[model samples]
Each structure stands twice: as structure tokens, then as C-alpha cells.
Target: MTEGRDDRGVAQTGSNARKVFIKTYGCQMNVYDSQRMGDALGSDGYQPTETMEDADLILLNTCHIREKAAEKIYSELGRIRLLKAERANEGRELRVGVAGCVAQAEGHEIIARAPAVDLVIGPQTYHRLPQALAKVARGERVVDIDHAVEDKFDHLPASQAGQIRGRGVAAFLTVQEGCDKFCTFCVVPYTRGAEVSRPLAQILEEARRLVAAGVREITLLGQNVNAWESSDAQGRAIGLGGLVRQLAEIPNLLRLRYTTSHPRDMDDALIAAHRDLPALMPYLHLPVQSGSDRILKAMNRRHTAADYLRLLDRIRAARPDIALSGDFIVGFPGETDADFEDTLTLIREVGYASAFSFKYSPRPGTPGATMEGHVDEGVKDERLQHLQALLRDQQAAFARAQVGRRMPVLIEKHGRHPGQMIGRSPFLIPVVLPASAGAIGAVAEVRIESVRPNSLMAEGAEAMPEAMRLRA
Candidate 1:
């Protein structure tokens, strides 16, 4: 039997603290979600363990963005089920739980198929994890995917920012959740619910806490991050740009970034933030799913090729040095040879620093799932290969451009070699340099010596003076 609950509904320990192992897969927001889940369980006397074998409880924080995500979950669950039996024979109880988008989408199905899973909590409902675990301890199989009426963020305990930042110098902080733009290929709206921006006070408090805990950089996250809107301390409604300006006010936060933006929501003020906020990193990931006007219409993108280019022009006008990344779906339903070529033309026109490209996979319940003219498997494979090749070349070119340039890098971790440490350029390219763990969290000057397809090789600026370096 466990100790009784407290006034806050936190689960009390029976005698010793339990260990929880979480395997997170998906977007940066999911990473933030997993960290918050760990925080929620922290009050329940549960500590995190990296090793599955040593864990008393295991949670799979899943993603449903790609195809066969559910199948992947079941496959992993099978392995966990066997582990549970093995633990039972050893007279140890192993409770399994599933959380996040997959859990939200397939709650009843998951529990019915895998009886070993003790609980299924949605992405939004994880704030009540301790109470859910309490139910599981009482032999009740709990599946709570319903959207909580109460604010989940308000209920979650303050993050152990220092402890979490110890895992990484940079951290992901989600200021918004869900999506209102139901992209034909996305399951976010269905799984994550409607877009809701956290209040300004809550976001600022979290950022301050992270900074207090030794974090030097934070990447703001959301499905549509630029869509975020909240009131100021004075209750004046403001957009994501305003929120970013406020965050940049934190004394110790060295770098700031935000991602997964939509072109439609790229307001004037947010675009201006890129130019105005010195702390904001000069990289943006704006997804333009298709380039063909016909396909964009079919996808309900609402923005045309011309509109996207105009938006890009405005953004470049605001911040000339801003590096851009984009999301592309090559084989969407009804895409023709002309459409594909148009996409290639756009790629050449925009000259992407780096971007993500994927073959279109129809998500269940999304309009695309039932749409006619699904591209053949071979065609999708071929198109995806072609798109990736172009993206690779562009990315390589961007990396090559950095050689001989003195750039500032925020060190993130130790490199593969003894004297090497790794960090990222403002363009988000990982760079390997000569340093130790002591360099982590410090943004230092480095001169790029060599460039690879994926990373840059660099030397300390003091070691390689400007006069000795080769110019691009």
C-alpha cells in the first residue's frame, strides 16, 4: 500500500522514491511536455532513471505525426509487456503508462489491446499524473484523455530548472499548445486540440525559473508558435513578438529561438522581432507545405506561392542576415509533374539554408486520408529522394559559407574526440571545437576551419587569428 495523498493531491511515497523512465519521441514541444511530466511526478516521490531495467514505472511519451505511429507504439509495448512479466517473476511490479498524442488518439484501443498498460493520459491531462498513478495503484486501469477544464499549466509544479538544464545547456520551453490551422496532413488539431497560448505571466515565470536554474538559452515552442498571443502584465493583448521582447528582458538568457511557424500568421511585429531583438537567434523554421497554387489550395493552405515569396521578402527586409528553414511535403494528393517542378523552382528561388522534406502521409480523419489521387509509393519515394538531394546541396553550401568566418557558438556538449566539444552556430549548425565540459553554456568566439555536410569544424578564435584564415 502507498502513503495517502496530501492536500495538493500529490501521491505520497510508501517508503522509498520510485524511478520513472520516459522515452520521448516527436517535436520539441513533446520534449518540453516530457520534462513537465517528470516535474509533475517529482512531487509524487518519483525520480527519473535513464535505464529501463532499473525503473519502477515506464512511460512512453509518443508522437502521432508520421505514418504507422500507432503500430510503432504497439511494437514497443509488446517488448515492455514481456519486461513486465519478467519483473513480476522477480516479485517486482512494473507499471506501464502511455502519454502524449498517440495516447490521446488511441486511448481505449491501447488499453484494450495491451492490458499490461496501467494508464493512458493525454498530452493535456498529464498534469494530473500523480492522481492517475494513485488510481492505478488501486488496481483501476485509467485512461484519461479528456481535455482538462482547469488550466494544466497552472497545476504543474515549478520545474527543477537547474536539474533539467544539467542535462543540456539549452532547453525547450513551450509557451503555446495545439493548432487552429487544421492542415490536411496534420493530426495536431485532432490530437493536441485547439490552439491556446499560455498567459504572459506563466511564460515569463517559467523562463525566469529556467534562467535561475543555469539555462543560458531557450527555444520557445508551439505547433504554430508565431500564432501565440497573450496579454501583458497590464492586460493589453499582444502577439508572440511582444512575448519574445519580454523574454529577452531576462538578464541571463543568452540566446532565444522559436520554431514551426506558419506563413499566414507571420505578423508584422513578429517579423520585426527578428531584426530588433539581439538575443533572438537569426533562424526561422517556416513551413510552406507546397509551392503549386493548385496544390496549396487543395491542401487548404490559403497562401499562394506569390504570397509566400512576398512574406519572405518582407522578413528579409526586416532582418537581412536571417537564415531560413522550411517544411515541405512532396507527394501530396493530386500533385502533378508540374506541381513538383514548381516546388523545385521555389527551392532554387528561396535558396534555403536547410529544410525538412518528407513524402506525404495521409493522417487518419484528416481530409487528405479520404482524398482521391494518392500518389503511388514509387513516385513518392522518387520525389522524396530528389527533394532531399536538393536540400542537402543547399545545406552543404550554407555550411561551406561559414568556413573562415569568426562565429559565436553556444557550446552544448562534449564531442566524439577527447579534446573536442560541440555547440551550435546561430544558423543552428552543430560545430565541433577544441574545448572541455567547462565550455558548455558559454557562447565563445570560434573560427570555422572546415565544413562537413552535417557539422562544422572550428578552432578557438584566439588560436586562429583573422589574418591567418581563408576568406570565403
Candidate 2:
């Protein structure tokens, strides 16, 4: 969201510490990876620099979710290549590196094509970054993409940025990695590897550390978050629901949530936890991807349109005000107009609070890429526009419905104007209100004043009475 390299306006130097500038692009998991990467370099005495010009090491944390995104990574490499040359002319050391899924996918190509890249470490081997950089310092380019069995989380040092930046009121902690469901159009299973959930103790420890560093809300992240399972305090096995319940016990941890969950993995206990744990915000981002049973089968989604609706029915029955969000891929291969109509029908039926609809872009080696009847680019574009129009209308209507309600918003950052701070409603819309710096990281009751197409404008916390504020 920050513009250009110097958007954060961080100082160039800090106690003679060599600065590392990280440019992260992609999902929440990629964001979390960038933070840990910075921490890795931080332990080796490198501080964070917002500007690319001042950085000794510049890493591009990439996502390989789609072909277009991959090309953009290469284009960014071109710009960084020029920057590397400029730095060399000034006799400044600028080590360009590639990390995350892109590194895992194309490490050698990057090394061969972009010779300026000195380090290429996959998400799994990013824990060895300091060692790889040491090799780079010795004038040898490094490429390490092995799927090491060890836990990278254990090797990571305490993030200096966590102590400094903290990533605002809410933070993402990845409790699960990779995917087991090999969807035809997905590359996460290859790039992120098989499904693996972190130990319960490890996740609890990280949550406590994050909370101590001033994070009020934590979203447990994963390619399939609901698939998470680990032991409880009594050595009994528990699902993600139990984890949320346990996390709710933490003092000052105001809210809890998880993302990118699968309908099949939505256990009864987890649904019940949604009803019981008010700390778990009344929102769910369950990605359905498509509505046509034929397309769903082709995508290897292993669920039908009716099945998803039934699952949602149960979930909503448990937590009545639990707002729903979903993901949709509009133009998958073999998606006919009737298929598209089915999608729109499901969309209307669900009444989504928000939805992300994208034209399907095939990735190499995926079954969908080679499948017959691939939707034409023009058709894909048209369908996406139509799907997005419907979704936007739904989003706007949902925001309008909240115009007279009082909701707890977590203050994330300062607004552009003086005495103005911005926060996110439980539904994840940005709300601007006149406030002081003290409001950051606090959940304040805001009376919705006006509804925008995307976000909402709200009155300050003072407008809401004490008895009406959300406590749980």
C-alpha cells in the first residue's frame, strides 16, 4: 500500500547498521515471510531502510500465483538491476536477492537472467539467509531451494522491526503452511509444499510475543487455515477452533480471525467456537472459487455448490451476525455462460459482505492450463467485469446497511489530515475518524456516519456511549 521506495520515510542510517529494504508483493503469507526475512538480516546487524537507494541488501519477496504476476516480478527485477548498477557506480554494496515462492519456482532462471541477484532462498530455506548472505559477501552467488525438513520458525530471531514497526494493530501469524488439496489451477502446493501445521506451543509462543509487541488482533494465516490441528494444554488434539478459543484467553488480545479456509475442513466444533468466541470477530473469508458443480469438479475442489451453501447455512445458524466473504474465479476453462449464471445465482443467494473475483489465469504444469476450452481473454475480461460489478454492488449495499450501527474498529494507522486516524471495521472496511495518535492499536466503538463504495466514514469513539461499546 505504501507508494514508491521511500513511502515509510525511514532514516537511511541507524547506529552504523547496514540497511535491508524488502519489497513484498502477494498474500498475507508473503507479508509474514518478508517480516521474518527482515528479522533474519536484523540478527546479522542489518536495519530496515524504506528507500532502495540506501539499502545494502534488497530482497523481492514474490508470489507465483499467476503468470502475469510472475512477469511483473521479472519487470521489477529489471528496475532493481538498473538500481544495482547505479549503486555499483557509487561504490556502494547493494546485494539484490529473491525470496519466497518465486525463488522456489525460478531461482536458477533469476540467477542466469538477472546476474545482479546474489542470493536466492526459498521460503523453507529462508532461515539460512544470514549464512547465504555470508557466502554472497565472499563473492559467490547463492541459490538454495531445497525442501528442508527443519522448522524455519525456530531458527528466526526476534524481529527488530517487530519491536519498531509492529505492522500496526493487527498482525498475521502463519500457523499452517502449504496445501494438501491439489487444485487444478493452484501452484501453492508446489511452491509452498505439502500441508504442515506448526505445533500448538510454537503458535502460542509467537502469539504471546506479538501481543507483547503491541499487536491487539492476530489473524492466523495458512493456504488452508481450517485444516490446522495440534495438541491443547491437556495433550488433547484440537482444531483451529480450539486454537482460537485458547488465543481468546490471552489478556489484551482483543480480536482473532483466520483466512482462506476450506468448506470441507469446517468442523462442527470450529463453527460452535464462532458462536462462543466473541473475540473471534464476526467475519469469515471462506473461498468458494466457483458455483458450477462441473467447474468445481474440474478444479479438483472436491465440493459441490449445494455443499458449500449447506456449510454456510450451518455456520450462519451458529453465529447469526457473522458476515461472510468469498473468493471467485470467474473464467475458468470450460466455464460456459450457464456456469457464469450459476455463479451469479449463488452470489445473490449468499449476500456476501465482500468478495474477490478474478479472471482465472492458468499456471504452468497445472491441469487447468492444458485443459481444453480455455476461456478467451476477452470473454474472461467481460465476465470478470460483470462479476466484479455485482460484487461491488453487494459490498456497497452491505456498507450502507451498517450506516446506523455501532461497530468496534481496530485503529491501524494515522490518516492524512491532522487529528485523523484510520481503523478497520470487523468486516475489514477502512473507517476514517477524527482522533489522536493514542487511538492506534485500540479497538474503539465508532458510529457509522456515511457509506462509501468500498470503505465507511465514521464518527469518533466519543460519539458512542460506554454501555453500547463492544466489550467481548
Q: What TM-score does each of the candidates earn?
A: 0.93, 0.92
Task: Give candidate 2's error at residue 234 in angstroms.
Answer: 2.6
- In model 1, the runs with Cα more than 4 Å from the true position are 1-15, 436-438, 460-472
lDDT of 1 at 160: 66
lDDT per residue (tens digit) for residues 114-146 in model 2: 888898889888888888887887889999888
lDDT of each structure? 0.86, 0.84
Give per-residue lDDT, candidate 2, residue 335: 97
Residue 464 of model 1, lDDT score:
41
Cα distance off (Å), candidate 2, residue 140: 1.5
lDDT of 1 by residue, 1-472 (tens): 4343433555666655578899999888888889888888876767788998888899999999988999999999999999999999999899999999999999899999997899999998999898899888888999999874766666766776545666477889888888988878889999999988888998898888888877888999999989999888788999999999999999989899998799999999998898899889989999897789999999888899999999999999999988989999988999998999999988888989989888999888899999999999899999999988998888888888889999889988876655668899998998888774247889978889887657888864223444433431
lDDT top scorer: 1
Q: Which residue runs of candidate 2 sit more than 4 Å off their true CA positions?
A: 1-15, 160-165, 436-438, 460-472
Each prediction's number of clashing residue pairs: 0, 0
